[model samples]
Target: MDDRLSGYPDPDFSLGTLARMGSSRLVTKAHSLLVTDARVWPAPDERLGDTVSILIVDGVIEQIGAGLQAPDDVPRLSAEGRVVTAGFWNCHVHFTGREWSSAATAPAESLQHALDDMLLSHGFTTVLDLSSNPRTTFALMRRIATGELRGPEILTAATGLTPWRGMPFYVKADVPWVLRWLMPAPATSIGARLTVAAQIRGGAKLTKLFTGSYVRPDQVKPMRLPVARAAVAAAHRRGSRVFAHPSNRPGTEVAVEAGVDALAHVPDETEGTETLLRQAAERGIRLVPTLHMFASTVTTDDGYLAPIRAALGGFIRAGGRVLFGTDVGYMADRETRGEYEAMRASGMSTADILRSLTTEPAEFLGRADTGSVAVGNRGDLTVLQTRDDPSPADLANIQATIRAGRAIFLRDSPSKHTADAP
Candidate 1:
């Protein structure tokens, strides 16, 4: 849609608020971008020379060199020698916020603001929605895919399956009991299989299981091992990865025995966790240490925080893959700085953290093309404002979040930046 047609009077809509429309609605039309004078870390383990320029054409990296020439018409962004790397990915998130209820038909401006505030502004180019309403999630996906909205690439699991008679107390308190009772919690393997099959058929590319749900803060209900196995089998048969919410040791046991791909949380309970989690690591099961979620929502006391952080450090020691996620929509606080700090306390270095946000997620999703700044990779990149040559402890200091060569979220105004004229 043209600016006049959309009723937006801003002349720099493409270069400013909304992402530039590509020739093809599906492809972001090469938000045709060029970045000059930037230090680069192609990947966490691989570092490239400083002061390099990357040329992107048609949403793909065409070249990376200390000097690169481009057509005068292509838009150029001066990184001012900031640090550039592969785009960041948040492996867990939710689109269940009430604001997203209108995702399908919400005004672009309104929705864009909410998106920027929650995810993009913090440097997310891609995200995985663990569980959300299919109606809202699919609608959001369609609009973003068609170039109607500027947002991150979304992978959704739709509604998640819970154990029979199991619904988290927190979730139950949010709505009327009658409506909450309608939520799915399968008792038998057959019921679990059908739900998994139907959700995937409904366009949920991923599957989530509340293998353990908090009946009360201190009490839990574990999904039947057989039912969990059925759900995992059904999802894997369809080529979808399954994420599990192991609220405690029992839940972790169900997730492990049932063969879920990843543990969505660190199993909020500590007893018997270290041994089981190490076992999980040995099985090639990945973990998303939403440690910050625990710190913020639960207790910040050492008794609670120490054991949780220790579990994460132990998992990493046991070679468990760590994928970055904040449980953002589920928790009201969206800032990522605390998560990084907590991860560091868990003994992860700068490189370890970066890998979790980038390479690890790309590898986890079996997406070979992304999570690195290579010439042939997708033109998705995150630029961070660094005072020195590519070293930043807290990744929250984002200068710009670019997806497929388009600047979806620019922390600073483009006009004020020094760049070559188009």
Candidate 2:
């Protein structure tokens, strides 16, 4: 097997090879850039123009309009009639395994390849790791922030909280010892609250709870109500949003009653699921429809997918805020096309799907400056090679991914150029 393809370093490799291949340039330095001839969508609901030019300076959008000009020193990238939208956010992801946790210290070639294949290639500039080792994940985040690593802006929930004896059967049997150490089971309400405080103090920006834990294929154990309540209250007091993994209907109820800000998935479609979804929406509980995760786990039959689709459709119809997340690191399928198709099958409009990827998640994360292509916003853009009025699936046609005015991942094409004269 090819060592590079296997994500292992070659003994014959050296810094010269890394420099010659330009892996060092994978993370572009923040500088001025001019993007021209782009079909710009300022926001999911707002199309700016059919053809537009944007001026980016010092990692922020300085101007956006037609025929924009910049200094001679500023580089120009032509969109070539492609669609440019704000960068996408994957709200459900993980940084598990040795490859991810050691990203900061990994070889440049391996780390850059991993980032491109796992995250940037999918146009995700920001990601929320639902569950991961806080110390390692945060170290990776710091490396990215310092431009030592080429990756997305990451928000980690640190170690996730579960009830005593609540570890999922699959995880207990399949997950490695390193990952298992990250998930802690707090047996009591006091333990739950204390765990929440400790995680937050350890630099967790968000909190996650396994309100419903699947101990077996036929059995799910729900967290105690008082414990759930205490965890939520503690996280809220620390100004961190709490996300719940509701494995079933009973788990969804516990999460709702405990006031979790988001449901990590659309709960199992049982009787009264619609009512539960409606209540969740009324209570302002957002949902991350990890529909594709479910599809990947079960047999691809109507009998299996129908209920999940119906539940997602009902949640959408009830005006629930949906976030796009593919459970990438944990599930091992980084491609997002399946998730997009599943969401489209659930009757989500292209606009709704785009909002879930961009605007809604940005707002959910309290990042008013991102998720839009406008002057003064962070110059995080996803350029897609698609025709006018592209469908949701067209999102897979990524041409380049720009974060903070730097081209992190650009698809190779003979005609593609990072800089062109206007």
**The candidate that achieves the highest lDDT relative to the unseen native structure:** 1
TM-score of candidate 1 relative to the true fold: 0.90
Poorest stretch of ten by lDDT in candidate 2: 1-10
lDDT of 2 at 304: 73
Clashing pairs in 1: 22-29
How accurate locally, in lDDT, is each candidate? Answer: 0.81, 0.78
Q: What does candidate 1's lDDT look like per residue over 150-196, in tens digits?
A: 78988888778888989878776654554554466888999999888
Local error of candidate 2 at 400, Å? Answer: 0.9
TM-score for each model: 0.90, 0.88
Query: Least lDDT summed over 10 consecutive residues: which range in candidate 1?
Result: 1-10
Angstrom error of the Cα, residue 15, model 1: value is 38
Give candidate 2 regions above 4 Å deviation: 1-30, 174-182, 413-422
